[model samples]
Target: MKDLFDYCDFGDLKLNSRIVRTGLWESQREKSGNMTPDIYNRYENIAASGVGLIITELYSLYPRDTFSKYSNTIHYTQFVREARDLTDLVHVYDVPIFAQLGFVQYNKKTQQNMKIEDVTIDDIRKIQTDMIIAAQKFDFGGFDGIQLGLGNYYFLSRFINPNFNTRDDKYGGNTFNRLRIVLEMIKVIKDNTKLHINCRLNAFDGTTNGMTLTETIEIAKLLEKYGADFLQITLPRSPQFFTRENKEENPLIEATEQIIDNVNIPVILGGGANSQNQINEMLNSTNIDFISMQRPFVKDPSFLVDWQIKGNGESFCKTCNNCYWKKTATCHLRSCNP
Candidate 1:
């Protein structure tokens, strides 16, 4: 039986455990995305907590768009330095880390009100270059690989989804065409660095018009072709599901199984997978090579450590989705409000 603490060779990276930490926003950093002592302490604590791998939250490729609200800007070099410190600290524990690169949309406010750039090919190229630059820096700073948030509100996802992407060109079309931008971006990163890269794909858009299992499987094939060492699949329901109050299967794990069958590279299952029994089932299935946990750890970084020590898991993941609606930050690193 493979224990959570067991180290495994994943792609080109050596992960210390099968239980990998997914990216969760650590507002612990300064508003400008600069490394803060609190954030550093948090990483040290998590790394020390017996985790095999920790994937940092999405760092904006464009320093000007670091904050979700698009109000503050992070310093590129300073953020890199702080990121390096976190990497070095974690490496002492023999854990591998990955830095996620993303470009956030500016709804209204941005430094000096810089005009929101359209999704032009030039914009995509520049963003890809920035990610490559970040990857080289991360490798030098002691990170194992780089991952892209390909199908969400971040730039790549924004460009993929019809909801966020409205342009009608080669970059926009039926699913494969939409994937062109994402694949090209990955190629550039690989061309620039010798590190492994992970690209996470949402299993479902939870909408009638967005991603379906079919679309995701097709996307996964392309991801592997373009150089994704591993594919992390997650399912996120839209607000419409909450409004309709419909409760059926989330289809995340099921979709992951399909992706596993279709792709040759390692496939990871994440989202709502926190329990011991659930984790065992996923690992036992032989369909998934690894599992990623974001909410579970964000709620309680100590959960895994405690689970190993005392068989207790009291995490702060409310899963209420109120953090977006109430407009107030809810999961500020601690919450048992479930």
Candidate 2:
């Protein structure tokens, strides 16, 4: 029988266990996009917490693309040195880390905002180049892998969604056309670096005419064909989507099974996973090879330690989503803070 503590092979990367620490936005970077001591300590704690893989917080590849209101962007080469320092600390525990790369063209604060549809062919080429440059930096920084974030309604997801992409060119029309940018980026990274590639993809957007589960399954297969070694299934944040009522088994798990059936690569399922029982059940029932959590780690950096000590216990995280609103990534819950 397979267990959560069993060793798992994700492509060429070998994880110590099946627990993966998914990327959580930590606005702990310096003004110049450099790593801070707080960020280093946070990762160090997580590394020592017994999680198998650590996926770093979302990082923007371009200066104009701002994913969060508080976080800094890695637009300069100097920032890569700071990233290297963090990776080095995480490696000290012998845990592999992957950088989550994403971009957002428009934010309320930026003076010049551009949408996905506004991007021309030249702009697409430039974006792809920027992604390659970022991936190269990650490779140089000693990261085990690079996760291309094609979810969370970011730059890549916007281009994949039919509702957001209205272009008539080869870059946007059918599913193949929509995935062209992602495929090209994968090719560039595979050709230029030895870094393993993981893709965080949207299974559903939870809206009418948005990217549906069926389409995302096909996209998952295409991603595998294009060189993605691992696929992390995620969904857009919708109040009506993947509600807590069905905590025992959510639609994301079912969607992940569907994708797993089509691809040979390892699949990581995220969302609504709060306890050891939930993770074990998902892993046992579905073809998912691993499970990931973000909020639980924020609530308690030693979450994996607690899980190891106790066979199965619910995490203390209330899933309040307050960390997103705070100036920095912090849990306001007294239990988490005290």
Candidate 3:
């Protein structure tokens, strides 16, 4: 039996355990997109809590990107310095940290979302340049890796989703075309820096004509071929379908198995995984390399340590989804539960 505490090698990333603390949006940054004391404390607690790896909240690459409103933007020198401090703090606990990079183009004046079809080849190249610059800073800041967030309804995933991408240009139509930008960004980051590059891809959005399991599997293989260190499987936030109770195995896990079978790289899978039994069962049943969790860690930063002491017990997170609304990524029900 493979214990969750067992160490695993994710390319150049050497994890102390198989439990990964995936990224969760935490509205704890300053107005200048620099890390505040609150954000620092949150990451410090997580590092001390015994997670094998820590993937930071989304960091916007472009100044006009929609994510600029909520998450940190890495285009500024102050943000880079803060990120370096964060990496230093997390390293004190021997936890490798990865910055989650995502993009969302908005009009420079109106600040509204731009249409995907209107994005010209020049615009795509500029976006790629911005991403590479941000990644270079991350590498200089001492981050262990960069997780390209092409999932979670972000701008990158929006371009890949057939439902949103309706252009007749080279970046549209076929799966390969839609994936062209991401593939290019992966190559650019690899050429520019020595940081480990991981991709967080969406398997399904639970909508008609959205990214399907088959397409995601094919993309996973392509990402491996393009030099991605690993693939983290994720799903879009579709509450109506995925949140409903089902006795069968989680769809994300099933899709992850398909991708794992087809790829030679490590696969990280997680969605609504709140119990140690469920995590261990999936790890033992499937060939998934690691199990990731976001909400559970939000509800309890020390959840992994608690699980270790309790011997594979259930997590304390109730999956209330309140943290999503608060934009603080904290458990609002902690007082009531305690």
Candidate 4:
């Protein structure tokens, strides 16, 4: 039986638990994009807790992108220095941390949001080079890995999706071609940096002609082949689309299991789980070894400590998603939970 708290090997890194804490909004940061005391304290609490690994909130690749206002950007001058402090704090607990890097829109000068088909080869090269530089920053920051935000509505997600990327050039058309843009970047990052490359991907986009599980499986294979050290299976809208109240049979469980069977690298089933018993059930029933959570940690950074002590505990997170929509790091409804 797979236990949620068991020490395991996720790739080359040893984890204290199977739980992986993934972050989203960083509304608490300064307008200058520098880290604040609150951010450091929150990370310290989470690290002191029992999360196996920590994936920092989305680090916007560009400053003008849609989510940059709510996320930390690599363009920040203090990014490397502040990130070094954060990573060192997490390492004190012997927990490995990954920098989540992505952007929703591709805006250049005055072009605003560029369509996937309209992106020129020069644009593609620029994006790849920017990502390589960001990876190098994380490498200097002492991060254990980089979680490429290929999932959700990120630009790369659209660039690789047939529904959005209708280009006929070598960058688009077939699966390999559509993914070539990212695969090439992955190879570069692997050769250049030692950071473990983790790709966060959508299991299935419900769009009529967008990504499906079959294509995602193929994408997973391609990612693993290129250099991805691990994968996290998620949906398009993700946690917002999946709340605890839905109770509908989660398609992600079966989808993630199938993905795990298809790939040799570690696959994490992302979101929609809250209780220790529930997570342990999935851990034992499926091939999934790592589970990722966001809102629960936002509700209480040290909740895992309680779970570890109690053996079985349910998260106090109301799943209201105020933190997600309001774009705050602290939970909005936690005071009412008790």
Best by lDDT: 4
RMSD of each: 4.3, 2.6, 2.2, 1.0
Q: Cα deviation in Å at residue 187, candidate 4?
A: 0.8
lDDT of 3 by residue, 1-338 (tens): 97777777877777878888876675867776667888888889889877888998777766666556766677566766777899999999989999888876635455367788877787788878878888899998889899997887888889888989998988999988898998998888888898888898888887788888888888888889988998888877632223426455577878888888999988888666777787778778878869887877777777677777878677776666676656665678867452
Better of 1 and 4 by lDDT: 4
What is the per-residue lDDT of model 1 for residues 144-260, given as tens digits with 9 covering 90 to 100?
A: 787777755555665676655556778776777788877876787677776688887777676657777787888899889888898877655332232214456545667788888
Model with the higher TM-score, candidate 2 or 4? 4
Candidate 1 clashing pairs? 316-335
Could you tell me which 10 consecutive residues in candidate 3 have the lowest summed lDDT? 238-247
Off by over 4 Å in 1: 1-3, 63-74, 106-118, 162-168, 237-249, 312-338
Minimal lDDT window, size 10, model 2: 238-247
Q: Scored by CA lDDT, what does every candidate get?
A: 0.65, 0.80, 0.79, 0.91
Question: Which is the leading candidate under TM-score?
Answer: 4
Candidate 2, 130-171: lDDT as tens digits: 889889888988888999989877778988999888888899
lDDT of 4 at 258: 94
Candidate 4 vs. truth: CA RMSD? 1.0
Candidate 4 lDDT (Cα, whole model)? 0.91
